[model samples]
Target: MFHIVFVEPRIPPNTGNAIRLSAATGADLHLVEPLGFSMTDAQLRRAGLDYHDLASVTVHPGLDALWQALLPARVFAFTASATTSYADIAYRRGDVLVFGPEPTGLDARVLEHPDVTDRLRIPMLPGRRSLNLANSAAIAAYEAWRQLDFAAP
Candidate 1:
């Protein structure tokens, strides 16, 4: 399975929806702290995610810890500023597909990290801020799955 890493995720509902997506797709979901809301919030639960969704979610204390756990996996960060489209990358098992928080996006330091395998973006009309967080994740994940032929099935 591929890894889906959300960096400093802010909105509960976005993360919640992402949880459902991750579970259905069999991707491991990793949340890097500090998150803006409690994962236990009722709104999170109301976002169509059930307790089973949490089974695929893993909370890491910080980026450092996340890196330690997910080491050796190439990370392709999804950012609006990236010149390369997400489709250009060849994703493999153990590759990490990372998304930034909703409000501000990934921190510059993290985005420029030497360990980041690549920076990618989903093409949009000029002047658009971005696509919705959950929507972006779904698109990227599905494309990666497609590249893998949806994993033999």
Candidate 2:
């Protein structure tokens, strides 16, 4: 399974959607705090619907803790500033796909982390800013899963 890491995510609904995405794709979701909202936020619950129990979601106190827990895995930091496209990588199982918060993307420090294997971007129209956080994550997760043939046994 792939790991999806959201660093300092600020939106409740986006995180909620990510929860549903994780459950659907069998991917693990890790969130780095300070989260903008509580896990039990009403918006989060509404977006996640009944998939909360099915999702594998973990919360890390900080970036250091997240790094410590997920070290030795190939970490791809998703950022709009990245030159490399997200689809270019030959993603492997257990790889960590990292994304930043809604308003501002990954911080420079996080992007420059030693653990990050590469910075990647999803393609967009010439002047467009970015896709929704949850949408981007779902795209990355599904692409990785697609490369793994969905891992059906």
List candidate 2 segments past 4 Å from native: none
Best by lDDT: 2
lDDT of 1 at 27: 81
lDDT of 2 by residue, 30-100 (tens): 99999999999999999999999999999999999998998889999999999999999999988999999
Model 1 score (lDDT): 0.85
Angstrom error at residue 21, model 1 = 0.6
lDDT of 1 by residue, 1-153 (tens): 898889998888888888887767878889999998987877777773564544488899999999999988898988998999998888898889889998688878778988899999999998999898889999988988888888732
lDDT of each: 0.85, 0.94
| TM-score attained by model 1 | 0.94
Error of 2 at 51 (Å): 0.3
Each prediction's number of clashing residue pairs: 0, 0
